[model samples]
Target: MNEELNARLLELLARIEPLLPPEQAPIDWSRDVAAIWQRHALGGRLTAVAPRDGVRVEELVGIDHQKQALLDNTRAFLRGRPANHALLWGARGTGKSSLIRALLNDLGDEGLRLIQVDRHDLVGLPTLVQSLRGSDYRFVVYCDDLSFEGSDDAYKALKSVLDGTLTGPPDNVLLYATSNRRHLLPERMADNSDTRIEGGEIHHGDAVEEKISLSDRFGLWLSFYPFDQSTYLAACRHWVAHLGGRFDTDAEAAARRFALERGVRSGRAAWQFAISWVGRQ
Candidate 1:
């Protein structure tokens, strides 16, 4: 009995004082936070890819309706009016990004700053907001080509950034996004299969419908369709004349050649064709 008792006591001591397997030093959360805080401009100091002067809004040329719609929203934002979060959706290369950049130049001097965060960086938005929560200047958090492709988690983070569940979008911040997908998803035909829970009844109070409902978050939805020949030629003529390029490239003839070459027509094509034709200069 004594021997058994002694062995058990030894075992307990060994287990209790096993050197703690070389304890890992506690993580310094404050230091970690400070490090992150330093590297990221939580105060909303913007770092645009191309500085403002390079982006000339007055020179965007054409798409008067599209330009006017966006400029109006931007002006509203500048005035602290009840402005809507905008979603610029449509054909690729149709000045979606250009519009956002142009707005910064047009309004940057009005205490407005455009901070472009890459799509993958959307998850860091909470941290970003927390950092910039107390700033005085207004901000436009621009995301180019934003969409979901098995990236539901990123969307969740963006939902909070767009319209927070608890804090809501910071009064100083507005999100402007450009996407090719109208629904922001691939428009899967299968989504309809589940939106029906009891045969012909739209499924509410469910994840699938909830996900499909994300588009409603944005107040404005603008579409940029491919341009017709006249608009295309006008775009080419505008850019060529403005940039002082070789414009005698037969405006009408060049317009046809641009469409025939690309098999598509849009402001983007017009600009590209103009650049190519100017090589003749």
Candidate 2:
């Protein structure tokens, strides 16, 4: 009777085995230069971007100082030297994000990994950092167009990660973010309206402190400004030459008109003009 019961249990177990979930696959970290982490209802999802898809350093124009600063810092990091977390803050369409992508591709052989995290996913940073701690490849957790609003709790999560609790940032990882706002926080004139005076000394508002301190956490701050008309035109010329095309008098005038119409001369605006010209040809 005991042997019969045991046989019945074994049969039941075998029947349930195939229905159970399979073991999770190990992460293939070597697969890509950069990855986008998308948060889901269940957990997190990762999408890989091909290395060749990223822009090269030579392709960028009109931000030589900013570019060199980033390249030098990145090279120092890759050499196993101390490197600061970088913040690229400036105007829109000024190649802030491009420099990062280009640098990664430029130094691909050095095992640099770029993990792009969205503002919404900042809460998951601790988990992400832990997973990367033991990896052999160096990582730059990139946040592009990052900014926080007044009621954003995500900022707290990021603050904690950036502040580095006690253990500090993982040796193999760094945080690099680009933003149009220098402080990575939205500000209003009213935010400064409520200042306090303590011990006969006027102090700034809490809102100002909160916004500015986040940027201060970063050791390196690289600023990018909108390009001038000549810089923009030069960029257009560079792209034309690279694409094996010439900028005739009509085309040059048209490109200037395009910039004027846009009301902003920038690297991106220049590129758009170049691409449009190439299409016409």
* Top candidate when judged by TM-score against the true structure: 2
Q: Tens digit of lDDT per residue, candidate 2, span 100-216? A: 888888987788888889998887777777778878889898998999887788877677777748887788888999999888878777666665553353554765787788888
Q: Output the worst ten-in-a-row residue range by lDDT, candidate 2.
A: 195-204
C-alpha displacement of 162 in model 1, angstroms? 1.5
lDDT of 1 by residue, 131-156 (tens): 56666767777778888874467787
RMSD of 2: 5.9
C-alpha TM-score for every candidate:
0.76, 0.84
RMSD of each: 9.7, 5.9
Error of 1 at 146 (Å): 1.0
lDDT over C-alpha atoms for residue 243 of model 2: 71
For model 1, what is the alpha-carbon lDDT of residue 39? Answer: 21
Best by lDDT: 2
RMSD of 1: 9.7
Checking candidate 1 for backbone clashes, the offending pairs are none
